[model samples]
Target: MIGRRACWGLGGLVMAMAGCGPAPAPQAADKPRAEAAAQATGAPGTAGAAGPSSTGGASSAAGGVKADEATKPAPPPESAFTPVAQIPEDLEIRLHPVEGALLVSTPNLTVVEGEQTNVATAVGVLKDGKIDFPERLRVPGWMVTVSGVHGRYPDQLDLIATGTTGRTGVAEHYALGAKGWDQRVGDAGQWFTGVARMGSSLVGLTGPTMIGRSRFVTLRGPRVGLTITPAPRKGECRGFDAEAASRYSEAEVRPEAFGATRDGTALSYGRNCNGDNAVEVWKPGEKRSTILPVPAPSEEQTTDEVRTLILPGPGDGEAWIVDRGVLRYQGGEAKKIDPPAKGARVLTASAAPDGTLWALTDDALFTRKGDAWEQAPLPDGVKARDVAVGSDGAVWVAAGGAILKHGGASEAAGAAPGTIQLQKGPPPKPRENRTLPRPGGPKCPQNLVVLYTFSKTAPDDYDFPLTRKALKGRTEFSPARFVVTRDMGQRFLAAFVPTWDLAKKLEERIKTDVRGSTPQIVCATPEVVRELKLDLKTGEVAK
Candidate 1:
């Protein structure tokens, strides 16, 4: 629709078109340039003009009227590249239907070199106004090509995209940075087939990385610990090569299709080794991996199959996997908290830190408790990929590539009667011994921690006096490092504690005496809590 020749590279979801030029004849590599590509997001972004000659040459005057006006040809429409957004900021999103294909990017003649200019504008699928990149390619748009289209996944934040220079039929490669809209630098021209994100680095699935011509690829990244087979078109990824697989001799061998997850400052990797389908799940802090022989994705299955989603719930030491529609744990049988919907199927699921579970379907997001499911209130027009619970029981979800979270110090999402909610407010006014000094930064003062529980009215009824009585001889109070909330809907309370050991002991006592209250509590230093990835339903901390 943008009126430009577009090339649909790999699977058509990613296309590069810049006058459909052929790669330059092999010789000296092209020189690297300072300028880069456009922003990846949809928002209109700005960049320096490619170069002069962008200025149209004046033409001869026409008939009688204004010869100068006729000669100027209204300076070429401005575009080294059209403005794009990599990822849009928080804004209302809509799922608009896409036409056959949408224009992804285009090239500018001014930026062309030796006749090549990698993708001036590539065309691909777009749905609901979102990039709608397929599952494993949730973060698409890195690979580009010429003559013949190939895909490549370079390091995260940086990638080489090849396209034509609109004017010349020569291919060019641009090294793109993932930060701001203008973070790009051109490189010696080369074609890339596919690219993917693993750890903080980007891994390429191109032939150049192949050892000689073998599918075995030695990529550039912090985790070169992996070697992949370059069968991008087939979407088939297997174990690392014999040489690379030996690095992890301590555990089962040959981990491939390594997917990453964050558990605090430490990053964890999940792999489905070729030797066996069992997935090895581990992070820095853990002594032994939580391995499960979840069947590997069959050749017929999509990339999501080989990619095991390792969810670590709050406080809970166990990690689990989701297969087909059931959950497989390291030591437990396949199970689902609730039965599948009558016609719909679950798309994603997660465990809450407190032992609750959540499932996502085409129609709704459901919470599970004791085998029963309840629909959580959510706006329409969006679908979710995964669910996460916060340390303080905040519900965080990756929906439509955006996070919709509930609970935590910030105002929580979805306020309805009978639903879980995190309570928060300005620091309580200082009074008597409660006038404790404020701790610098985002931590609770001294050894203090915060505890939470259900209350009738968070602000009105979270009696400091009543809480003091509850702890009786403990120094826990408001704004504890352990907790940062007080909500009204579910009557949430945030109680402070002087020490974690004291906090733990008091928590056990309160849970026992509170009995049916099933009050939820969360308290930990900001840094420790930040590293935790929890389940939305139960408060379990995920690995």
Candidate 2:
């Protein structure tokens, strides 16, 4: 915690002893100096440090220690943040735990008027002691937050995320398919509270658009459109503010809690919006939801009702809600279970598939041991806010921007024995095509048009051969100059065809058939290519 605070302001001196005195006020004149100091620290996006005199000479050395030593930010506890993954020190990181993988979301931040605003979310996946952050997932202009991630039956994984365009929230589905990954954006008008991927169907719980009930909607894919289910008035309550409701959506029943297990998905609604609380449990493959008579938590039980977390229990029709304490719900009855943290605050908790409970508190992770709570062995000085137990019995912790794994197998996690494993391998070598010459810069036949260009990098480099084999009859391929607005100094495989219409048709086919290829249609003539300062062979930017 001291390490996290040290990076905030005042050369780490004031924040170290923040309680010792009144905070130093920022002055107009010191802004430039502070900015320079921030840049000097290699963390230009961090908040500026206070002026020297603002510390009242308090930053000076004490007990023969140097002033510089007192102000240096303390080394962060051993985790992935530092020398491990090389993530920037200043980005805000949030963790969402999946079955075998951990999703790390770091929002791109830029300082505007000394305040930071999120421009985009950088997505990274941690598995098998390594992090794989594909370049394409780092989308700009759209701010996306992942709400849930689920591993499908075979090699596929699906991400349930909400992308906001500053004006409206859009539900996004990222499905790992034969083409590596593809996204389907559903303009559901608002973000989903959470989603459950049951077998072949995806159902999401969101706020009620009208007063008196929360609504359930279907998400993404061709067969499933945005279909809203009307809510029952059983546990209707007035929870949302009248003014705020009109500001976002006219939904009446806001989702208060949601959770899912192998057996089913459960959700509870009735937040201050003029209704009593109701819990709905829907089993997989079932068209109807079973309404449970669950009451809302008393004010004394929870500080913020919106922050209440619901966890699916091991047994069918059972679920757990984490409010002030853990509450076990089954058979229309609620039972209070003693948390492993005792009276300490539980930051997050997870239930393993075998009914074991794991809870993370401020100090350490607690697991039930007989009748007593046992603390799991963690790296010394480590602090984490979230915990999840993998199916293989490995403990995963999300601290800051990095992921920490414990007790898992050394090999990368794999799909079940009967299921298809994730695709892995080196890039395939380009096929032998002797008759046609390799792509020459801007030397295309007058009738030839650029269909698509693929980067000569791993994963994508593998696509060249696959695309060649798949579309051998329709187009010709060559090493073409790949240009951005300017030369990117990278090698690329440019696909060419005789007509623009054929190129367009080929572009769509490649995106669908080729694995991991997202190509754009570009009709680059020699003059247009030269104007863009294009070159691909040497990977050196054209002067």
Candidate 3:
């Protein structure tokens, strides 16, 4: 059941960009100086002080805020925000709140839309947020929205926009491959959305009317395209939508074995159908007349039906096909490997960085090294649904809304898990525009927050010498900075401050408590916060 609960705990903090005018153009005389600064700081094309400043002071400022703020009683437990739901058994849910749409799918590729409560139509879901589909294509699976209108793949591919009446064009297509002919032609005026590439050949299927027959087309090159004549199937075998097809495109179906040579030609393994669950060998530049025999599963396995396939490395006729709980190596025959007993249902399979095949089950994770299968220890009481390996070779597991990262030694590896903390707090309220004068030292722009670094030599000295332009009045000049200290060796110390209203508050408290020594303030942008470097002391923004 869907539920809602208010978010609790220390909400993640974020920094935002302030409004600023366009930067001045650079002069010929300033070129050398700008280049030298870029070389020294390793920042290119950032001249005239128009771009964001460094984040060296961010960590110290955050630490300072924690040190000075009075301890407040913890708020009552929140019950209004529901945690993000985990993937259900046999069902994958994709939610796009910004577009007010949800997509639920089964392993067999059956998809249905959830009732949208919001007025917006959800287009696609993102790591940070969700985007809505344009009014042109109301069908969800037809087009995958990445970011903006231009954020589509292969610009040449024509997509359905809005019709003359501003309504979405509702059309369906079916892709069929027989012999010699491959065509995408359907009823003259209707639109269809099924197109995929098998090797170098493109296959498209379309069904114009719900009760009408479907047409199949194949395109080899720019000018060479074939329209297949359906051999007259008896019943309604052609009217199904793109979602009904067990396979769509190479982009959607994950490849198991690739670049393998069969009969002196390159071959790859791909899932055939949702019901058949067989992997077919695909060779480029081959005629559609060739048919490869489907391999059989081992005797211990009841289900020969493969769900997911993975090829560890470059090899001929070598691939790993996953059928239920067993991991089978496919060559001449399917050899099943005993999976970890603690594993529930296998969720996903992938080749680890070390060439070991790994699988994520409902209850545990299993890894195969050479011929031995080992079960990796999971966090106590945590159930996982999805897993992915990062470019850094670290494994990431997603359960419910929590994300855990595994790093370090083999035993220690996958042991320590870090949860993904999303930034929270009510969005900043809108404010009126106002102009203010520059202050002494490095003056931050109006609406810009600044981070200050305090010197350790004068640890007790926290007073800041403000220029008259910035001290006009509290109403006209209210700049905030957050401050914290860092240990540079045992004898030396550094402070980091960010450019924001919150940082200004820290500066005010320091000046009020400690007098004399002036603190240095620097600007920090939101990009620094994502780097995970903004802690209490070091001020390094997370990358």
TM-score of each: 0.30, 0.48, 0.32
CA lDDT of each prediction against the hidden true structure: 0.30, 0.41, 0.29
Q: Poorest 10 consecutive residues of model 1 by lDDT?
A: 431-440
Clashes within 3 Å, all models in order: 83, 23, 60
After superposing candidate 1 on the true structure, give the runs of residues whose Cα lies further than 4 Å from its correct spot.
1-276, 282-291, 295-308, 328-344, 349-357, 369-372, 379-405, 412-543
Model 2 stretches astray by more than 4 angstroms: 1-88, 96-101, 109-119, 127-130, 139-141, 152-155, 176-182, 197-202, 208-253, 269-276, 283-286, 295-307, 368-373, 400-402, 409-543
User: Better model by TM-score, 1 or 3?
Assistant: 3
lDDT string for model 2 (482-534, tens) is 22221122223444445544544555666567654544432232222222222
How well is each residue in 146-255 modelled by candidate 3, as lDDT tens digits? 11111122122222111111111222222212221122322331222223334444443332211223333443334323222332243112222233533112211112
- When sorted by TM-score, best at the front, the candidate numbers are 2, 3, 1
Candidate 1 local Cα displacement, residue 57, angstroms: 92
For model 1, the local distance difference test gives 0.30
RMSD of model 3 against the true structure: 31.3
Best-fitting candidate, scored by lDDT: 2
